[model samples]
Structure formats: C-alpha cells, structure tokens
Target chain A: MSLLWRNVFGQKTGDDSLAGFLGSIPLFAEMKPRDLRQLAALVHPRDYDDKETVFSEGDPGSGLYLIRNGRVKIFTRDSSGHEHEIAVLEAGDFFGETTLVSPAVRTASARTLEKSQLVGFFRADLLDCMEKNPRLALRLLFGLTRAMSERLHLADRELKRLHHALHELQAEGQD
Target chain B: MAESNGLTRGHVLLFFLVMTASIASGLAIFSSASRITELLHTATTGIVLPVLLALVLSFLLEPLVRLFERGPLTRTASIFLVFALVASGLYLAFSWLSPHWAEMWFSLRTDLPRYLGRGIALLKEAQARVQEIFPYIGGFDLPSRGRVLAERLFSHILAQTTGSALKIGGLMVLVPLFTFFFLRDGQKIVRASVGLVPNRYYEMAHDLAWLISRQLSQFVRGRITEAAIVGLVVGVGLSVTDIRYAPLLALFAGITNLVPYIGPIVGMIPGILIAMVDLGIGAQFWWIVVVYLLIAQVIVDNFILIPILISHVSNLHPLWVIIAIIMGGKLYGVLGMIIGVPVASILKIVIIEIRYYRQTFALPLGEFDS
Candidate 1:
C-alpha cells in the first residue's frame, strides 16, 4: 500500500511532455522505455526560492540537476567569497556533474535567478539500479557523459569570451 | 599581460602528476629507508582521512552548527551537543549489541569447539588423502617449518593487529575532537589554505579547492548516512526474523560496508559464521543462513546501499577500487584497505582538476585523447 501510488503512477500533462522531451534527448536516447519510466518516478518537479541555492560551487555535490522550468546560474566563489557567474542554465539544461565524475567540489554555485524547477538524478542511486538494468544504465551513462560534455563546452565558450574581452580591454587601456 | 607565457590546464596537470609520481615512486623504491616510508602512502592517507571526514561531517551538520552558532549556547556547548549526539548513538549501539554478543560468546564457547573439531578432523582426513596422493607434502614431518611459518605469521598478524587497534582507539578521539574544532574554525582553515596560493591563479585555485573539499565532504556525508540506514534496516530485519545476535551482526555489516565493494563480503563472513554457529548444526540452519544473507543482500543492494553509494561515489573506477585496497592494505593493513578506495577516488578527482588547471593556464599543449 505504501508503494501503491508510487509503483503505477502517471505524470501530469506538462510533466509527461517533459519526460517525452527527455526521451528525445540524444543523451538519454539509449534508455529503454521501462527504465525511463522508473527514472520518471524520481524526477519530481521542484521549485526554488529566488536567490535560493540549488547547490554551491564549493559544496559537496552528487547527482545531476536539470532545469525543468525558469532559470539557474552556475557561478564559482573565490576564497574571499566573491561569486563569479559561470553559466545561465535554462529549461532542458543540466549541471552539478563535474562533482559526480571527478569527486571535486562543484566549480560554480547554482542559484535560482527566477523561480526555478529542477529534476535531479543522483549518480550512485542510478548506477546501482543500472546493474539490474544494464540497457538503461548504458543510456544513462551516455546522458551523463553528454551532460558533462555540454557543461565543458559551455565553460570553454565562456573562457574564450573572457579572453576576447580581456584583449579588447587591454587595447582600450593602451589607447 | 604582454606577449604571454600561457600554461594550458593539460600542461599543469601533467606536471603535477609527473612531479607527484616522481616523489612517490622515489619513496616507494627507497631500499634503505625506514619501514615507515613504505607506509607513507597509507600513513598519509590516515591523516587525510580524519581531516576530510571531519570536514565533511562538519559540512553536513552545518545547519545545526549554524543554528547553535546563533543561539545562547556557547561554541563549546554547541560542540558538546554534536559530540553528545555521536556519543549517544555509539552508546545506544553498543548497549544493544552487548547482550547479543554475550549470548553469542556463551554459545560460541560451546559451539566453536565442535566446529573446530569438525574442521580439524576434515583437515586430518584431507592430509591422509594427500599422503596417499603426494608423499613429499606428508613427509614434511611434525613441528616442521610449516608450524613455525603459521605460528610466526599468526603472531606477527596478532601483534600488528592489536597494535593497530590500540593506535586507532587512542587516536580516534582526534577524529570527533578535531571535527568539533573543524566545524568551529573551518572557515579559518579554508582562508589559510587559500592564502597560500599566489597572485596568478589564486582566485581560481581557491574556488577549485573549496569546491573539491565540498564534493569530498558530501560524498562522505552521504555514505555515512546511507550506511547507518542500511545498518538499521539490517538490524530490524534480523530482529523481525528472530535471528540471534541481530545487533552484533547488523553492526558488523553496517560498519564493514562503509568500505565499498570489499566490505559487504567481509561483514557477511563473520555474520554467516555466527549464524552457522547459532543454528548448532542442521539443514534447517543452513537454509536460514542462506535466506538471511539473500534477503539482506537484496534489501541492502537493491533498495539501499548500492543506490546511495553509486550516487555519491560514481567517480571511482573498478581498477582504482582494487588498486586503492591493495595500496591501503600494504601500508596500514585493514584501515588502509578500508579508507583506500574513497581516498583514491578523491585523489583521482584532484588529478583531473590539476589537468583542468593546466589547460586553463596554457601550461603545455598535449593530446586530449586521454
């Protein structure tokens, strides 16, 4: 009875579309239908208070957090506690994986700029489940890898922009 | 700012790894060095483990610390509150186990003798069988080098084990005691560690260090929480089944399982043997043993332990797991074996971060295929 509601539940209308969209994700393309269903159960849509931290950059992190609605910012804080924006995460975006892959502190903090909703999947929990369902695990692995790769791609772009801005500022100062 | 000297994150990481390896390899290969040097890898980990665990525990309990930090309670009182919680948990755990273990001991005193006799008879019969098959092995007479080897190995093991236990008891006071100080002055430590960085990448490295520290702490916190839950579940299950030594068996299972991969099996052996002894011989006993272990495994693996663990420690590879155990075992023996996997995972992350630093700094250009 405790698990009755959980075992055979259906997502609300918008939530169903979100699940559908996740299925369409190249990262999750490998996940089987049943496995996806299992994952869908855990992917609760959660809202954050504005300026509320989803996770801090230096805080211990596990699982990947995906923006389901609204926006979150990834920013790293210096030792002096100065925050630096790393990326703006919107619907369909994910973060917090660098910690999962490397066991390092998050490189940046994730704060809700607007009222935000995110769905999360902890790596440890999912992997354990994956053992029983390797096909789904493989799909998740693909998704995790892609998720990480996407963040790095974004960080790289940011770094390039910083470099260009620095050069421009240097030229301007000389003039 | 001029025509620049750029260090890529790749270059930084390579230099860091190569340098660290060079130092480590030197120490590992040093023949004339103290036996202590051989344990440096493990001994170093012993120090890091307490500090890291303390930091993580502090972080997880930050809300409580912050709550008390704002309250009428003094810093010392707040710390005492934390320690009291830990102490009570330990006390309650021990209290529950004491009676169960007493029962086990009483039963063990009676039953172990029979099991040993059975084992001895089996060994003697096997020896006789081997005598018929291979004369030389049997020819090695009574009180030969075998006894000496066994005796020496056992005595050495006993001495080392006792020494390690004593050392652990003596020093584990530092873990919670330091944890209290860490929770209180953690910011000071972070500031100091950050201060050591130079003007160049000072900001970046500080961010990274804090992040790294946070990640490691979360992993430990999550593991501890998950382990406790598993232990509680196991204890309840055993109690429900009317199994003997439920507390002791669950305690062992819970604590041993703090170590990944190797722990469950390690914890199970003692419990299985205890169960075997408790049953006092019969097919029914064996069936109970099989079922308890099976159900316990299912609940712990499927529902609890693995799910939580994999979520936190997805960074560690199987190769690293084995290597860490071996390396830890070689150094501090069992403790090293226990702490080695998580430490290795953390270190692996550090290595990757160093690599990330190199690429960011333009320290050197190398293939990214790795």
Candidate 2:
C-alpha cells in the first residue's frame, strides 16, 4: 500500500478511506512526526483466521501485537474446567505488550472473533522503542495493565461463583 | 482518555522521575553480584514466603472466603475460616508425620552406620567383579569427589546468602505485612494505587493490574500443578521400578520442579546420579534416565503444564522464559529464578500501564482546549 494510504487508513491512509482513525492506537500515538513518516518503511500486515488462536495461554510472550482491525477474546480456564472470558479487545486495542519485560508463559489465550489484521513487534524492536521513546514504552504498559485488570476482575468473579455454587448446593438439601 | 482529564506538567515530571528511578536502580543492581544477593535474599525472606502463603491460602480458602463474604461469616469471618482450615491441615500433617519421623530418625541413626558398612562391602566386591564383565566399566569406578563437590555447592550458596552481612530476620517484614494487608484490603490497595494516577491514566492502571495478576497467578498456579504432576509421575515411576527412597526422591522432585526451566534438571540430577553411582548399572541407569526425563518432559512441561498455564497466561516464548530464568538467577540466584517469570511479567504490565498513563495524561495536556 502507498505511504499516505496506509498512514491515513489502518496501515497507510489514502484520502477517501478510513485513514484518519490511525491516531487512537496507543502504540502509534507516541511516534514522532518523522518516525511516523518512516513507519511506512517498517509496517507489515498479518492476517488471522476467525476462531484461530493467535496465541495460546502459555506461548512465548516475546513481543507486542497491535490489533488494527477486528476483535479478540482473551479468556482463562480454571482447574475445574470453567472457562471465563476476560475481555473483548476491539480495534485500536493493543495486546501482548507484556512479552518484553516478562516473556514468561502466557496468562491467557487470544483468539480472533473474526478475521483480523495485526502488527506485531519482537523483543528487540520493543527494546529499541523503549530506548528511543521511554514514554511511549510506558504507555504500552498502561494498555497492557488494562487487559490485566480485566482478568483480575474475572478471577474475583470466578472465586465468588464457586462460593455461590457451594452455598446453593448446601441449601438445596435443606429446602 | 478524555481531553477533560489531561495530565498537567507535574505529571510529566513524575513520569521522568519513575523512569529514571527504575533505570538507575537497574544499573546499580547490575553492577554487583554481592549486592544482588543481598537484594534477592531480601525479597525471598520478605516477599516470597507471604506471597506463597497468600497464594496457597487463596486457593485453599477461596471457598471459605466466599462463604464469609456472602453470609454470616462475611469477608473477615471467611478469612478466619480459611486460617482455621490451614491450621487444621498443618496440625494434622505434623501430628501424622511426627510419630513416624521420630521413629524413622531413631532407627536411621541406629541402622545407617551398619547399612553403610554393608553397602561399602557390596560396592567393593561389585567393583572387583565389574572388570570381569566389562573392562571399560571397571576403570570408571565410583566418584571420589562427590562429598567435596556437595560441600562446595552448599558453601557457595551460603557465601552468597550469608556473606551479604544482612540480618535476614531483621531486614524487612513488609512482604508478609504487605501481603496481609493485600489479602485484607486488596481492593483498597488497588484502588489507592490506581487512585494516585489522575483519571486520565485510570484505564492503564486498571489494565496493568489485570494483566499482571493474571500472569502471576497463572505462572504460580501452573508451577504448583506442574510440581505436583512431576513429583507424582517420578514418585510413581520410581516406586514401580522398586527404587529405594521413592518417597524422598519424589518429594525432592516435586519441590525442585518449582524452579522452572532449571527445575526438571535440578530434580533429575540427584535421581540420575543416585541411579548411576549407587545402583551400579550404568547402561540401565542411563536408559532409565532417558525414559524418565522423556516421560516427565511429555506429561508435565508439555501436555499438562502448557495447557493449564496457556489457558489464562500471556503467550510467552520459551526462550524468554529461559532468559528470564538466567537473568533472575544471575540477579538473585535460586529465589530470583523461582519468582522471575511472574515478577518479570508483572513488570511488563506495569511498564505498559506507565505508557498508557502518559498517553491519557500527556496527549490531552498538549491538545488545545476547545
């Protein structure tokens, strides 16, 4: 795609398309004008099929991923085989930024709700970004934390649900 | 973030301060191994024990905590119930084990010397006959340096841990106390933490906490499950093989397996070494090891651990895990390596949170108000 086209739109913005919406994604927000201009040099697009897991719960968290279009559902399964959906991250929502600092096993599995387009960064690229723009790196943390908070809430709910189920079972015999 | 909640210039300054502090501390700690040991020991004694207890408590007591939160117990009562359960379990286990352990100890003291003498004689005779069976096996002989090697390893660990000159007991009680408050006022703590940030950065803080907790929980819980499975598999396998000290070896395997990346290796070393050195069946021992490690690798790390962890964890690459393990080990030795993954993952979430905060606060500050 042409530079302006990709820039204005998702990757490059042409005049008529959805190019103007590029500013919202936290990943691209902190780029310098010159850097943003040069992004056309580096940006590559990836495609994922619907219901296909882009990443699993314990995959290598090597890098960050940007969801340019479509939706992703991040969920966790408990020991008793209960699966709890944590978040429905939509476009402009950036995921997987936790890989750079703690590329430990993944905490949740991510799968596409639909065919999706994403841009990703490996550890080296992220470190480079941190080196050049530390503020930008911090912003990435914020976005990642949002996703995490969502999951914590889910864990809290899960704990509560287990309690509720047990209580209901106990009351059932009494009733 | 809405333009209404733009970050002021002070917010920008605070950002600079945090970044500099994190970077400076990183550099300082990186400069000295001794300092790193001090740092690590500080955390292990301080944070690790409470976090571990809290985690186990959370798991074991979640049901009770919920009951207390809901009805007559309320949240605090539920906490008490959880404690009650924990205390009961500990009491039961100790009572159960104490009588047997005392008996074992008395018998062990009495019989070990005699067993050693007999074992030595058998080994000596076996060594003489080994040459007749296979010339190459006869030359290898028993390891003479085993005691020295063990003493060295223990001394090395002691030097780092004790040499730091830090009074471990007096150093810090913040971890347990902090963990206590965390368990009690986790909500308030999170709120107060997130509340410090201006409204502009709230989303980031929220997200970061979510991600960090999830990753930490997944890793910790997975390791627990992984350890249990490894211990069970190895314990069962050895018992089935008619290996001596099956229970002890199994316990050792389970405990060591918590060290991840290096865990299985640490667990295997003693098992394999025992088989080779004492059993006197080198080829068979080596074959047993291959089969043992392969099965363990499949059942625990691969089939069991990966699935359980991945269900809720951020997909992390194995290379990164190894790197984290190495860095953690280098920084804090065993404890660091043990806690490395979750800590590292949490830090990543924090970093991401910091970034999102700047965006919410910074971008709006620069924008011209309508």
Candidate 2 residue runs with Cα over 4 Å from true position: A1-175, B1-64, B99-147, B154-179, B282-291, B311-319, B348-370
lDDT of 1 by residue, B6-41 (tens): 877887799899999999989876753667666775
* Fnat of all models, as shown: 0.00, 0.00
Residue B177 of model 1 has an lDDT of 74
Q: Write the per-residue lDDT of candidate 2 for residues B145-208, one digit (tens) a residue.
A: 4334444654565566554446444333433344445556765565457557532223344445
- Candidate with best lDDT: 1
Per-candidate chain B TM = 0.65, 0.62
Return the top candidate by DockQ: 1
Chain A TM-scores of all predicted models? 0.70, 0.60
DockQ, all models: 0.02, 0.01
- For all candidates, the clash counts are 24, 51
